[model samples]
Target: MQADIYKENGFFLDEWQLLEDEQALPTEPGRFLVSLERFVAAPEAFASLPEIAILVRAGDDVTVLAPHLDRFTMVAIEFAAFSDGRGYSSARLLRQRLCYHGELRAVGDVLLDQIPLMRRCGFDAFKVVHEPTRRALETGHLAEVPLYLQPAARPDEQPAGARAWARSPAGLAR
Candidate 1:
């Protein structure tokens, strides 16, 4: 099937790029998105393929098979339903257990309120559901303010010990 490609800000993207299940292995070098299930089923096939990586649903449980965290360019968490928080945990695992340092993305059934939690977990990009208007993608995928300070393995942030913060002086006066 011909995938729907959205273009905005001079960039073109296959809507499936947001979903780990919908994307396919790369035919050429560079960045390639893969289905987490297929990767877990047969990761050896991808061994020869390099320079690019995959983004998959957190439920794929592919972490045990991941050879190198840097090999992946991105990891996308799939939210099959708004109530399904498995994706959120997947994001956290990618940062915690797998030590992934690529663009973590949130895909499928994304809700506005979930953005904050998604970022906290790990997702950096979002593929909002299709809707009317050209800017639907923008309105659907919102960025959270103030980068997370927790001990997370983010792409460009320092890995730290347990997150700790002293009580704010303003609150101590109370």
Candidate 2:
């Protein structure tokens, strides 16, 4: 695999402007994406790309696209800067309220510190801009733990899956 970035929450800087020129897009037409400007400035563009992916900024006019999300394959949210956490909330809404199952990627300012929280809010992949050193990335790996956890061990969070599992015999054995 050529390392597709739908796995990270960062922007693929090399591919940022790939769609600026309409003709540059793949003629086969499988996935399409729109920048925040295009979606906000011209809603018609959404209709033009039938099954495309889109990129949106947190502050952009996202409400306009709410009704048209089903037409998209994925909606990649741009962080622009790491300090901006608005994208996280947007991702949460897309998954929880909108019921968006398509790919959701986090691009731009993808810092190492944000992956865990990003996944919680519904981001599946990232185009991590600041690729961490081998040691730093490896440190976060918990071999003893399962691939996933419920409730996140946060004070106010709860996991329905974990709760249900705890009621089962298998859960009781653990």
Candidate 3:
């Protein structure tokens, strides 16, 4: 699992493994990933475990984590399907709106092409189960357009023509 998890520093083991169902909590004693509903229901149940954070699924209200942001070490947004872009908005809200400063992770159905967009949206870590993505990330072989047309949490320079919407990578005068 370590090699599959990608971060800015490099791949690392998922210290707090993700749990799909709350019913499976009994088997996982220490730190683990919990659902939005389960964690919001009774956060005190896991008050002692700092590593136990919530995994918000697509369409789930991320505002619920606002009050409990201080208690979490990480927040993982699930992308059940790669085509579902709901997780991207969720990540944006967590970072830009709520101002969460913890480790924001992108989990489930993460692909090679989505990594750059994910980082721009404020995802610091990614759970890449796709082999091609892992290989590309491990080899530093990625194809991404450094220019952007929309604003994001990660700051970018002006692309060209002074167009407010367009942005180029930092240090590159476009």
Give the best candidate by TM-score.
3
Please provide, for model 2 over 9-108, each residue's C-alpha lDDT reduced to its tens digit, 9 standing for 90 to 100: 3223323323652444445545556675665566664565556677878686555667777776778889988789899878877877677888788878
lDDT (10s digit) by residue, model 3, range 1-174: 246778877788887866666364544357788889888888777765647778999999999888888878889999999899999999999998999999999999999989888888899999988998888888998668667766667656453434543344543555
Candidate 1 or 3, higher lDDT? Answer: 3
lDDT score, residue 57, model 2?
82
Q: Give, for candidate 1, the lowest lDDT window spanning 10 residues.
A: 2-11
Number of clashes found in candidate 2: 16
* Local distance difference test scores for all models: 0.61, 0.64, 0.82
Q: What is the lDDT for 2 in model 1?
A: 31
Model 3 misplaced regions, further than 4 Å: 19-29, 156-174
lDDT of 1 by residue, 61-165 (tens): 646645756667666677888888888777777777877778777777776667676777767776655443224444545445454555554566553433333
TM-score of each: 0.60, 0.63, 0.83
Clashing pairs in 1: none
Q: Which ten residues in a row have the lowest lDDT in candidate 3?
A: 159-168
